[model samples]
Target: MILPCFLFTSLFMVKLSQRAWNNVIIVSMLALIMLFNLSSNFLNDDSDAPAFSTLIPQGLLISTIEFSNAKVERVGQGWRIESKLSVSKDLQGLLDVWQSVEVSPFEENLQWGDSQPKVTVWFIGQAEPIEYYFLILADKTLVKLGQQTYQLVNVNYQTLIPTE
Candidate 1:
């Protein structure tokens, strides 16, 4: 009778151990799935949309970027920035990004107030400067043409005009 009791106890322990392992495996898989979802930028839905557009026009060299208060102009092979706010250390990289920046059509139509910040890009040999009204929000930067609005996918507000 004692031998039978001992055998029963051992089988119960084995069963509990197997059940605990199964639970652990399920929890691990769930954790992995959650991690993957968090790592991906789920809000960026226009992943398939192409970045390059005719906004700036290809092959044309940019001459100057005039902001509301700041100015960045091409100087020889490099660029010179004039601004009260501290500019990025990689000024050339920032300019190159603006030159060929990727943009997507903004979903909402925004009404511009009287004091909306603006930027004008002047290209070499071009007669007219391309003007764009910009709004810098917490999460994204929106650029407005005459009637259409676009979201700047590659760069942000602080990247273009850093406070620090």
Candidate 2:
């Protein structure tokens, strides 16, 4: 429908000898394309967040263990997360462990210095419900026992790791 309207208006403009109208049509098309691209980027991010969140298990105790400083970047991915945790205090004698994971770019055209994105972390243990938390930093932070859920918001391009 839009294409037909544009074509008809273009033809009418040519007949009326309105070159400026043609330029306006071209600019309008460009602007429409740009808006579509921007909206698509945001929609894609919003859609993916839920799928990732579903990967976490429910009903288990959870908490964030660590976080890092936000690192902004111009190319290749946006942020990463490093986590260290103690799952259960009763399950003592086990070594304290840390996991590092990379966070993909929220938007394909996301340039450097854009608003920071959030990172969600989930921990699922044997016979245990999933735990998660949010963090603002991108580096490692100490996590206590019995709290297993962690969520991190506004994580930049920094890497997160477990300290203990």
Best by TM-score: 1
Residues 12-76, candidate 2: write the lDDT tens digits: 65654467777867887998999999999887785535333222223432233223332211122
> lDDT of candidate 2?
0.36
lDDT of 1 by residue, 1-164 (tens): 69857865765577467677788568869977997887776765667764436456678888998987788889999988888878655778777667667778887967778677787889999999888888888889888876778888887765665334
**lDDT values for all models:** 0.76, 0.36
Worst 10 residues of 1 by lDDT: 49-58
* Model 1 CA deviation exceeding 4 Å by range: 1-55, 85-88, 162-164
In model 1, residue pairs whose N, Cα or C atoms come closer than 3 Å (at least 3 residues apart or on different chains), thus clashing, are none
True-vs-predicted CA distance for residue 72, candidate 1, Å: 1.3
Q: What TM-score does model 2 achieve against the real structure?
A: 0.26
